[model samples]
Target chain A: MIIAERKPVDEIVEMVSGVKRVLVLGCRGCVSICSAGGEREVEILASLLRLGASKQGRTLETIEATLVRQCDREYIEGIDQWAGQYDAIVSMACGVGVNFIANLRPLDVVYPGVNTSFFGGSADQGIWTEQCAGCGNCVLHLTGGLCPVARCAKSLMNGPCGGSVGGRCEIHKEVPCIWQAIHDRLDRTGRKEDMSRIAPIRDWSAAGHGGPRKQVRDDLTV
Target chain B: MSFTPDIRVFCCHYTSQQAIAEGLAGLKNDGFPPNATIERLLCSGKLQVSTILKAFEDGADGVCVVGCPVNECHNLMGSQRAAHRVLAVRKALNELGVEGERIEMFHLPRGFHPEFVEAVKQLDERTRGMGPSPFNGGTAK
Candidate 1:
């Protein structure tokens, strides 16, 4: 899932400060799973904005709506009638959702309520950590099912760097060195022989380095 | 008219509410104000941030969530989850520039009527000192 965190309320308030009517849009997608934007979050944010505005002797009208998945066109299409009613919108979704809504309704001004972080999973309730970089490649099978690209501090594909000490990353004591983890796993799986074969230089074109990526499937396309 | 703060207390049914009922029965009037209202929840863990904000939006000066003592919760970790949720909501309140201390959590043992009443009294006193919610008399709801 994509990980995200709510932007500071002060920044959010500044986005729709002058607008009398603001719609708070939430997504039940990745943002909801991470607790950044959901039905409950939409209500909480709307209430906070209203309360914050009230303290300044200004009245703010906030409406709450949660889409099934803001990244999907079908889900956001039904909101066509409601989109025109608000002066501005507060999008409590990932950057994709916010951009999707903006593209769907060009007339409404949309402000992001959360900062899109990375492709990750929940470490625990209310805690999340990045797990994947979506490099358009999979190297887990070669490295004991752990992608050093996402886990390593330096994204090294070879082995542990000099910075890895005591099985922890030098940059942060709390972070477990993924290279060490990979070594242990390879040893346990009797695949330590695979480590001796040096890997060739990786291709960078598949990782969105060239430009904005586009995918087309002739079988699925209309 | 003298100012009286409105405190909304959400009590979990099994433990906290049991104590609150016993406490209310033993008191004639005591420290509770006229606006103090108790809402019963199956478990305090189910308490959402929206509910707390809604209480303040509806003019509550203070909000309290009382649940079973940490490990003694009937729903396993419901009380613990409630504590975490309360802390998160308090942080959000602070970010909104409102008094985060206006909301509190009390982990009360079963049949501890006196402690339950005492917790409510603390909330009442603290709320009185803070006057009304900043959203009061405003068109926020």
Candidate 2:
């Protein structure tokens, strides 16, 4: 799932400064699950905006709406209900949702309320960790279901880097050495032999390094 | 002329039972600030950051949250959750250039206790010094 966190309220207040009316948009997708941008967050942000505006002796009218999923075209159409009611939009969705609004509604002014962090999963309540780099490659089978590209600080393919100490990354004691965990996981599962094979050089094209990446399914396309 | 701050108090059911039982006159006799309004909640954990912000948006000069003592909450971690939510509102208030102290959280024992009144009095005093909320176009006194 895509992980994100809201930008500071001050920055958002400044973004919509002088705008009399604004739409606070939310997405019920990965961001909602991660608690970054959801219906509840939309309400919080809208209220904060109004409070901030009031503090400045300015009145800001905010319209709150949450789309089922802002990434899809049909859901993006839900925004039409609030068309012309707002002068600008404060999108609480991840970057993709913000882009979808921009791409579909070229005339609308949109501002990102949250910063898109990475493709990750909830580790616990109120906690999320990056799990996939979306490098257009799958090497989990070779690493006992762990991807070095995301978990490993250096994304090392083979063994632990010299920086690993006591099974923790040198970058931070809180970060476990992914290679160490991988080795232990493989050993416990009787698949340690998988580590014996050397991994080949990785290709970077699919990771969006060449440019924006796209996928089209001929069978599903109209 | 003295400033009477409009303080909004949100207290959980268990912790605020006594205050609710006291009736308005009894509370006034017990020194409850007349400017403060008490709202009872089933559980503090059910409180949301938006709710606290709404108080300010609705013209509250200050806000206070009273919940069961941290570990003694009837719903286990309910008060703890409320504390976290209050902290979130405090951060947001600070971000908006308002005094974070305008809102506070209190973990107190349930039933009639002087601490409950004391918490309200403290907030009332603090808010009185702060004058009306910036949202109300008043500066700190």
Candidate 3:
């Protein structure tokens, strides 16, 4: 799921100025799953904005709607019929959803309600951490399942460096040494033999050093 | 004479608004406070708590949402969704130090304007006694 967080409320109110009728649109996809943009959040924000606007004696007509996926056309069509009634929309989806809403209608100004963060996994509920750099390399087989590129301070490609202190990285006391974690996981899985096979000198070309990569799924598309 | 109240009401179109003429007559008795204002909505089930909250935020002493009763929604279950939302928002308002009674919901079947007006007037009195929203407390203007 796409991990995201709400931009501060003040920013959104400022962005929504001069609007009389506003739609608070939420996405039930990634952003909802992550708790950044969802039905509840939209309502909460609408309440907050209403208070702010009312304090200024400016009344605003608000409509609340949630689409299955803001990034897709079919889901957005759910609210299309009522689009003209609203002056503008505050999209609770990620950046992709924001842009998609923008492209769908020339008249409505789409404002992002959340800051799109990264492609990551939940560390736990209410907590998420970055896991992939989209580095274009699948080296997990060599270092156990843990990602060295993301967890290691140096993004080291090899075994532990001198920075390993009592099994923690030098970058921060809280971070366990990535090499140690890799070693422990390999030992637990009895895959130590897999580590003996030395990874060849790092292939910089395949690892996005060669620039953008594209893979066409012929079967899936056709 | 008992003090009448101005209850801000949002009547759903298909059911409540469709029955407004009869409802006004039904509510013309002293049961409804004189200061109340009635607003219309596409569906009471369409009323999100934010709509109610914004009303409170807009300085309405209280907000009353009248929708088709649970089983009678024009959109089939829209009222149920609104009920669920009202419950959740009540919890939120409580947490924010706002009175839960400031936001309320009721079911209105088609042709039940009398019942609808009574509900609105009663709610208005209840809220007027509670005073303006704590968030936009009276005359914070």
DockQ winner between candidates 1 and 2: 2
Fnat per model, in the order shown: 0.69, 0.91, 0.38
- Model 2 error, position B108 (Å): 0.8
CAPRI quality of model 1: medium
lDDT of each residue in B1-141, candidate 2, tens digit only? 688889999999988887888987888898999989999999989888888988898889999999998999999999999999999998988888888899999999998888888899999999888888988998634
Ranking by TM-score: 2, 1, 3
Residue A186 of model 3 has an lDDT of 95
| Top candidate, metric DockQ | 2
lDDT of 1 by residue, A114-166 (tens): 99999998888778888899888788889998888999989998979998899
Better of 1 and 3 by lDDT: 1
The alpha-carbon deviation from the true structure for residue A208 of candidate 1, after best TM-score superposition, in angstroms, is 2.7
* Residue lDDT tens for model 1, B4-38: 88889998887555445646544435555456778
The best candidate in terms of TM-score: 2
On residues A1-222, what C-alpha lDDT tens digit does candidate 2 reach at each position?
Answer: 999999999999999997999999999898899898999999999999998888778999999889889899999888889988999999999999999999999899999999999999888899899999999878999999998999998989987989999999998889999999999999999997887889999888898899998999999999
lDDT (Cα) of model 2: 0.91
TM-scores for every predicted model? 0.91, 0.97, 0.59
Q: Indicate the docking level reached by candidate 2.
A: high
Interface RMSD of each: 1.8, 0.6, 4.6
